[model samples]
Target: MTQSDFAAPSRYFVDESGTTGDLSRAGAGLDFKQQPVFALAAVGVDDEQGLADRLAQIRTRRFPQAAELKSSKGHATTTVVSELLDAIDALGGGILLEVMDKRFTLAATMINTLVMRPVSPDDHKPSALWFRMQLAEQLHDTAPVEVYDAFIQACRNPGEASLKAAFRAVLQLVPPETPRDSPAGAIRLFTLDSLKDYRKAGVSKPEVQRRFLPLPDLGHTGKEVWILPHLSAFTNLYARINKLRDGRLAEVHIVHDDQPYVAEILRSSKQAVEDLAADNKVMALARVDYRFVETGELTFTASTSSPGVQAADLIAGFAMRHTRDALAGSRPSLESLKVFHRLANTLDGAPGFGMNLMLSNRDVLRCGLLPSQVPPMQPS
Candidate 1:
């Protein structure tokens, strides 16, 4: 057998930023918020040792004091991160990313989740009944209007239970080819919070028309059931990986920075992979074999322990800083955002699929870029 048959598969280094925006600081405009976006970034490489060594060289040279490297610092930090990015691309690694502008996440949804969470204050919070009543009132023109209205109000707050019910109410309105008998919580977690890449999830035109009501017409992206900003970023990255290399390798793996909420990440990713492998998701089938996700695995490591994970940390951190700058109307000069953008060219001789962006409608209209130029996944 050829060496290719036995060569170890590439390990994808993944990292994320802004999972929890400053909820206390959330206000009227996106610009003033401390955290305007959430980003998940990854780089794929076959030569794990080589890439790790190169990154160590840069770190040793730039941060000789054994000082920690952070992307939010000054020009010198940019130099370190930019060079590390260059090393990855030079070594034939592929990059993928997803960025979500969270300002578009509806206010009503965030309040609902906050109310349901365990640590919620015991008094003065709006009950689930009141929340549903408002949804029924506001979505009077949408498909769920009748369902929301007809559903009996709860005696008190539904807590986490409301999440499944809200998601179920929405999905039941759509005409499924087969009846959906699954539990509402299962349905919400499996589909809305799915981690499989969008490309692998088979969200093409045909499936969209088949699986969902006119959701966009309802004036929000199913926000009541899911907190989409960060989740979308993770899914988009997974999808992009499948898109670029469907048949080249036996498997793919991930090493990501440790996070407190790792369970959410792992759970969504597993479901995504499982859904892709299911018989009905045709576009997903085109992008990945069932074994790809079924057999694929991931491990989380602290960045200090794993250079690959550290590299991912720098990549995501640098990208998040750029986006935050963009929000505050602070322009990153040639030595900043420009360097990272240039590094991207080394991988595929283009901007590369390493970057995916989602922006609020306000930013979209203000940014001067055409809507067609931006990918459709970002919130409108």
Candidate 2:
């Protein structure tokens, strides 16, 4: 059963953090200080057994209770979290990371549906950035930042009423033309009507200043989340597929953390890639057709059986900490988040290879956590 006895395949171990299935409820259940970002992370290994050995060693020495490796403790202190991340980094495999900005997502999703404005020369599906830019243009330049700052401050260790009032304020800034059944619409209507209600009352109390939308109560709880770890894997693999093809090695086994619904997402992703491969889809990054994926069998196994998955969990914590800090308006420090700025397996000296920052410019600004080495947004 020793790792030295067997050769490992080219595979990725993936895990996720900050997932609240329903997008709107991202931070709905967690305490207000918690991050609302969703991130899926993967650690790719050419030698899986090495990673397993390292993890086993880390657990026995650093994580006494975790030696059994049942499940991640959901949160680890900076020291424990760093030890795990360092172990993964020492393995030398490239890391793949993806972050989802919920605030931007919430606003963007609503604006896309509610606003009828068309782009120049054509009517196409509005992009998240486009929606934000549109709203930013309408604002007094400082409104978005002021509103964003208010929400950030309000959500910090917020109580139920605080959340209601805070989100109601958020709704006011993006209210739709007419009230609708959707939460986005409701928040929008509330966001707008609350302003009206407050103005009519002619009160400037702190409560009135909150611009809260009235709801039945403030103590509702929990929501679901979908973390398509495979999507991160897809991006990771796509970046390397051309190289794999060039090397005449088109096979890769995916190793993922034993999360719910993972197999289905992987299978679905596999099929989609297969279909695209069958059609000879070209990847712009590699400037080659997806022949690599077509020729390869992307067989994946759950992480309960693989040590690589545990290493990927290290990345989950790294992401969790960075996300929380990023939300609080600070970047991850190398002393605290050693792996936050580390870039391995890069292409053309890019800050990330399989690693991707999923947040938009607007949210990044809100968090005040832009790293010096972060890559510029790719031209889509």
Candidate 3:
């Protein structure tokens, strides 16, 4: 029953923090607020027995009565968290993490669906993506909060009426009274007109509608069509894993914590990535930073059965708490702060390979946490 009995596969254990429920409730005036941030953490390991043994030793000394390591338990204490970090470091493997702001995500989704659709010939240009990123951030930061609220409501029950309302909400944004030719005024006007055109052209047609709208996918019963944070983080992590092992002889597989509701979608999503990866030219033109490999499998298992998954849970929990507090402008205990710095030190060198903040540039600026604190945004 010991991990030492058999050689371990090249595996990365994964887990997440924060709820993935519908984000529209915050706007529905239902006294609901989803977790402001969502995060996924993956810890890669070449030695299962080494990780298992380290975890076992930690449990034996610090929490003899506990059956398993749960981040929610005392294992998140500064000392225990440090121990877990050390455990990961000892394995000489890499880490991948993703964090997002849910509100900013909704705003970005609305902009992508409404203003930037029908991929123009120019959209493939090198600067198009950067332009869009800036525009999305501007809209998210400056648009009336009602715009996002309405968009969220529409996504929950995407119909002609709701979609119309969402589109109209976007159109209501009035550009600042700046010089007519200024970048600020120009971009706003462009965004407004784009929304108008998209609405006039028919926002409900099948061609336009198939791109992740009509949320809470009734067809799949429990499935949702909106871009879930879990999917984005999961895919991003996979790319990083591939990058970590790009030229290596070993295969990389992921052992994820069981997520019954989203498991099927996760598999389908991975397959979809593989399909996309088949087109080398497209990926190259897009300047994708990583590639998907054919040698690995993504499978789900219970955390109770895998020490690696438990360790990931601990990492995820600490990240969630620390990030949530930092965003709220609250300080952590001295010990937690020390450990957080150490954690940041580990992430500093890896850039995108280690931890990533998926929030908009505007949100990043508003929070004022990244420049001197966390690692800078991944190199484009």
| TM-score top scorer | 3
- Model 2: per-residue lDDT, tens digit, 1-380? 12223222356666767654433233433332355666666666677777777767666776677643433564344555556656655555556566655554433332322222223323332343343344433332223544544443343323444444544555566545644664345445534554465556544455543333211111114222222223433444444443433524456565666554444555555566557656756333332234444344445556677777666666665666566676667765556544454422222222223345545555544444352233222211
Give the root-mean-square deviation of each candidate in angstroms: 14.0, 11.7, 5.4
Give the C-alpha lDDT of model 1. 0.48
In candidate 3, how many Å is residue 59 off?
Answer: 2.4
Residue-wise C-alpha lDDT for candidate 1, range 1-380, written one tens digit per residue: 12122222367888877666322234443342467767777877778788878976886888766654555443236787678766865676656666555543332232223212112233212343233223322332233333332211110223224333444454565445433353333233333442132225454444422222211111123222223454445554555554555433347776777764443445455566557556434222222233333334556778777767767677777766776666668766667656556433334322225455455434433333223232223221
Clashes of each: 1, 9, 0
By TM-score, the better pick of 1 and 2 is 1
Model 1, residue 107: C-alpha shift (Å): 9.4
Give me candidate 1's TM-score against the actual structure.
0.58
What lDDT does the true structure give each of the candidates?
Answer: 0.48, 0.47, 0.63
Candidate 2, clashing residue pairs? 20-224, 20-225, 21-224, 21-225, 22-224, 171-191, 172-191, 175-188, 329-367
Ranking by TM-score: 3, 1, 2
Clashing pairs in 3: none
Per-residue lDDT for 194 in model 3?
64
**Per-residue alpha-carbon lDDT of model 3 for 1-380, expressed as tens digits?**
12223222368899998755545555343222536787788877778789999988988888889987788775766777788778877676556677767666665556556555425546534565455556566676677777776677667666677766776676567546755465446455765676566566677764444442433422136545555667766766666565545523146678999987677777876776666666542222221233454646889999999888888888888877776776667756777767756654454544334466667654444433353332212211
By summed lDDT, which 10 consecutive residues of candidate 1 come out lowest?
210-219
Off by over 4 Å in 3: 1-9, 22-34, 118-127, 176-187, 203-206, 209-223, 247-250, 281-290, 293-295, 344-348, 360-380
Candidate 3: C-alpha lDDT: 0.63
